[model samples]
Target: MGNHVETLRWNGSAIEMIDQRILPHRIEYIACDSAQSVAKAIRDMVVRGAPAIGVAAAYGVALEAILRKNEASNVFSTSLEEGFKALAASRPTAVNLFWALDRMRKLWETHQAKNQPELADIFLGTAHEILEEDIRINRAMGEYGASLLPDGSRVLTHCNAGALATAGHGTALGVFRSAVEAGKRISVFADETRPFLQGARLTAWEMVQENIPVTLITDNMSGHLMSRGEIDAVVVGTDRVAANGDVANKIGTYMVAVLAKRHNIPFYVACPLSTIDLSLATGEEIPIEERPVDEIKGFRDCHWAPEGVSIRNPAFDVTPAELVTALITEKGIVDNTTLTAGELADFVKKNQ
Candidate 1:
């Protein structure tokens, strides 16, 4: 396995997250002392990925509890509700964020009769559990996903789904790490995810750090490589998966899935159970977050596009379930190509 990277941690007083916005160049941590600060960090992308956001939001709820431990019951309850709403509004596409918040909220409601200090301790403990559980879940998903690739497989991935994206081991990248650990030779082709450039910066950096063979390609280069039979399989991490197994991932994921279908290459989505939202009937109902037009202009401060040109920047796109060969989950591998909404929902319920 690759070197374990701690994406975020609770230091007893504050939740500290690695600033993903300036990664691979400047290594910095943003200390969130309140739920508002944690929400801001999520909005600004100081910490990202579905699992990482969920864990961070868990800590955000705990931080709010700690911050309001000495306040009156009425004030404490009102302030905590405000914190929940702020975090819930930070990101719309990732179901894990709302999942974690709902879990914490339910726990708080169930134990609200306790004193404030005790309640704060319970929240902190639960947050710690969520963080640790995420790491375990990712490793399990890695094992299940790694089994899908044979020896000497060339895996193509989009964006950064490595350890930087999650709590410890990643989702999609975790499969590569796991396969390599099991004595399977796996090389990687990372897409230079545009605007943010997470793959060019974060994914390449992670693979290089762990001595895994990696090739960087522009976003448009995947189809060309696949046409040449250079790509073995496509593995990606999802922000959310609908009841019918429709996947919502990075903005370019749908194009990649369609290309994989044309090439007859297996396309896999490494998804955790928390990312699955059974309430959504289909991908058409998934809310796509439109980022600021400034992101389309250029990376950071380097602007290349001419000013005043309108840019539509949807942060993510949905891939139909039929395009997905399978979904590698912590419980097991889900055959998604022929999965029905009812079957998928039943699987989720059985697992839960």
Candidate 2:
């Protein structure tokens, strides 16, 4: 079998990101040469998924450094700050985006004494490191999460949290990959996340590429499947995990979690430490990104909704800590009891 797909790569001169907007049918890469272009790509969903977006944002800073390699010290510093802000603003729900940009910002602040050329090299190196570390961290998460599954486990996943959603192996899907690698038989049920269809277009497509068994279901079909005892577990990736372990994932994730609980099936959230936001005390505090009305009206230029209907398209919804079975992280797993008391911060502190 071939190696896992790379979601994005720093190609010496630019960040080459797989165009997520038109996948399965067409495989193309977007070459981002400037921080502005990278920001646009993130906002436009050319490259998405919390971890992937974070990695792309780090590369955005590197692109800024490369562009300002010949500028004066003050000019370079000012432009760098602007680049960081732009990348941070590209998406608000994912803490990883802010976390990655802040890391780059701190690196620049610490190395202000270096010349533009040196700074450019340092920024590029750091971006590459971030990208590589994401894959490593995801695999570590995969190992821990995979251990939670039994033989012949059937997992229900939301959105496109496969290789397309991360730097390499995915968060939720990574767990499935690890279990399969460990010689456990496993399959997946992917929800066709509406208004985006990331699950249908990306997740299912990715599973086929990896030779993982997958079943496609509409967003509303989850509870029905669970009611019939078809789903053994529900595992999904989050854009942000609140201090209390309340998960903010794709819009339908809360429903899936609720159904999983009703069916007495384990609902797990696979995430990295970077995706956890200690600043947010609860999921209620996590910002929900609302998309343009066009997305709700149609997909990729196909209009189906009535021309005058209203739409509320919140990109994500928060699943309270009470609904979570466990929080799977690169550090370790935190049970729902620990998560509910809002003690995840304490767990992270001790582990960090």
Tens-place lDDT digits, model 1, residues 1-352: 2344568877769999989888788788889988899999999999999999999999999999999999998989999999999999999998999999999999998997899999999999999999898889999999999899999999999998888878888999999988988999999999999878899989998898889999999999999999999999999999999999999999999999999999999999999999999989999999999988889998778888998898999999999999999999999999997897599888888997
Task: Extract clashing residue pairs from model 2.
Answer: none
C-alpha RMSD of each candidate structure in angstroms = 1.0, 1.3
TM-score for each of the candidates: 0.98, 0.97
Candidate 2 stretches with Cα past 4 Å from truth are 1-4, 340-342
lDDT of 2 at 204: 94
Worst 10 residues of 1 by lDDT: 1-10
Residue 96 error for model 2, in Å? 0.2
TM-score (C-alpha) between model 1 and the true structure: 0.98
lDDT of 2: 0.89
